[model samples]
Target: MSKKLIDSGNNAAAMAVQLAEAEVIAAYPITPQTPLTEKLSEVIAAGKMDAEYVAVESEHSALAVCIGAASAGSRAFTATSSNGLLYMSEQLHWAAGSRLPLVMCVVNRGIGAPWSVWNDHQDAMSQRDAGWIQIFAKDHQEIVDMTLKAFRLAELVHIPVMVNYDGYYLSHTYMPFELPEAKAVQEFLPPYDYAHTLDPEKPESLNTVTLPYARLDINGVKRPGYMDIRHNLHQEMRLAMEVWEEIDADYAQRFGRGGAPILDPYCCDDADFVVVAMGSIANQFHVVVDRLREEEGLKVGVLALQIYRPFPTAKIAEALQNAKGVMVYEKGLSYGNQGALYADLKSALYPYPNRPQLHNFIVGLGGRDIPTEDLFQTLKTACLNGDRNSPEQADTPQWIGLQL
Candidate 1:
């Protein structure tokens, strides 16, 4: 049985972690991610959750604790935001490269030299190449459901998974969502059964220095080189997309929540124009799509990307093939070039002969408000300028909600 409850996104994630029965939680508070770890600590203290809560000294140490726990065959979790996530950068790579199946919640926020404790996707997007599976949640329910799914996906692929959602937008906002029963979550996710672990009885070195070429072990068994190990990680990451799709289907069958795994399309089947985004911003586009459809008689839809990494190139390309135009709105960009998602979408559609015209919009950095009117106008302009504008004009990324 599932119970409907109204709660903040952070609490939603905490509830999922409780249901997932994480054995070890290593956390250091960083807003808006602080409340999540706090809630977890509270549950453990109240005897509602059976887990070891380690309050670490810093964000780096937080992930370090999780790494140690996960390495020892324990289901471990951690949460952080903005600089905290950046501080754990090295451990992020170590967790993935070591093939530790751990899960983390990254409440997305802007990175700072200017120093603002606000919301953006920069924190997670900056770590796009960190070899971890990153999944974004658009609402409270997704926060709950995806957190549960993250543990399962991580264990299956033997890669760490980051469940990301907008910092204050989703993290602090309260919304109603169904909290799945502990029994149901237990049935969905099995106990962690890692094949390799740091057992003193069976001593072995892990992630030690590797030579450029394959080497023979003391027992004369052939072992992979640095490049070979990296290549295998890449292959497994790619394969994880299919694995996620299958897991999503099974989850939907049992829980009736997650059918669309990679790309969640809202009325895109017959849309002439599609707006693409991730996290809470994508949820906002639903209203924009409806207004354009009903008020302006335009066939526009919204496509929210659930999985940012593993790219899902083929599926994305196929989904947007029929549309005449696609407008990608992002909260983060790849500084020198363009919005990361925009660049990726162009690459995905490059092989198609009749690819749609693409446009990129950067919005809502440092907790800036992204009003619905702004999205509505920007999209309307893109629709009006479709295919007629010069290549340079269309290709250049535009900044929305910019005052200067």
Candidate 2:
């Protein structure tokens, strides 16, 4: 049985990490993410979780520590946000390329320039191609569920997994969540049995320098080069998409709770227009979807992207098959182009016949509050305009909730 508790998203995530029985947790403090690591420290000190909690000087060292632990055959974990994540950028690629089954919680926050410690996806989105499998949580329940599942998923694919949740929106906000039993979680996620690990007796070179061209090992056998190694990472990600679905299904069978782990659809079966969003904004869109459908009888729905890394192209195209228009709401934007997600979604649907009219809105940067009514109104206007066959009337990549 699970116990219900009202706690912040950080607590829920930290609890999940403990339940997953991570052996080593090395993290550096950052806004909205600090609480999570702090809680982990408390758990370790209190003897509730038996793990080595390392206090690192920086986020880079934090992930470096996790990589070292994982390489030594341990279930390693870490968490960070915004600039902290960027500071660990080099190690991020290292952990993924080295094929370490390390699980991390990235509390998504806006990036700096004119600095702000607020919420947005610029942090996580910026690291999209860093070779790690990225999964976003819609609410607190998912914060716990996905974190536990991340450990399982990462170990299965021998790839790193970053579990992302909105910073203040989800990380700092408190909600009632069910805490799963530790015994059950342990049963669900078995011991981390890595195929390869740094062993003294059974010695083998790991992460040795490989040139771009193919090379031969000491035994004169063909060995994969750098490019080949990178290609293998891509292949693992594609295979991970299938693995993620299976894991979610198995988890649902055990816990009686699970949804589409990638691209969750709400009232999208026969809808004419569908809103595409990620993270907490996806949860907000659910309210707007309900209001439009009930009050105005608008055939509008929402597609919340849960897994962004593998880029569920086929699932997205299938979900939007009957829709006449697709609108994407992004908390981050790509300079000189559209939003990252907007561009990706456009590409995903591009190959389909009679693709729906698409639009993108950049919203809620630096902790700016978005009015619910205004959001609904803007979407309704866009849908109405698209209905009039005026999809190309204005230049796209529009900015919403901006004060002139």
Query: On residues 20-139, what C-alpha lDDT tens digit does candidate 2 reach at each position?
Result: 999999999999899999999999999999999999999999999999999989999999999999999999999999999999999998898879899989999999999999999989
Poorly placed runs, candidate 2 (over 4 Å): 387-395
TM-scores of all candidate predictions against the true structure: 0.99, 0.97
Clashes (N, CA, C under 3 Å) per candidate: 0, 0
Deviating ranges (above 4 Å) for candidate 1: none
Error of 1 at 216 (Å): 1.7
Error of 2 at 255 (Å): 0.6
Full-model lDDT for every candidate: 0.93, 0.91
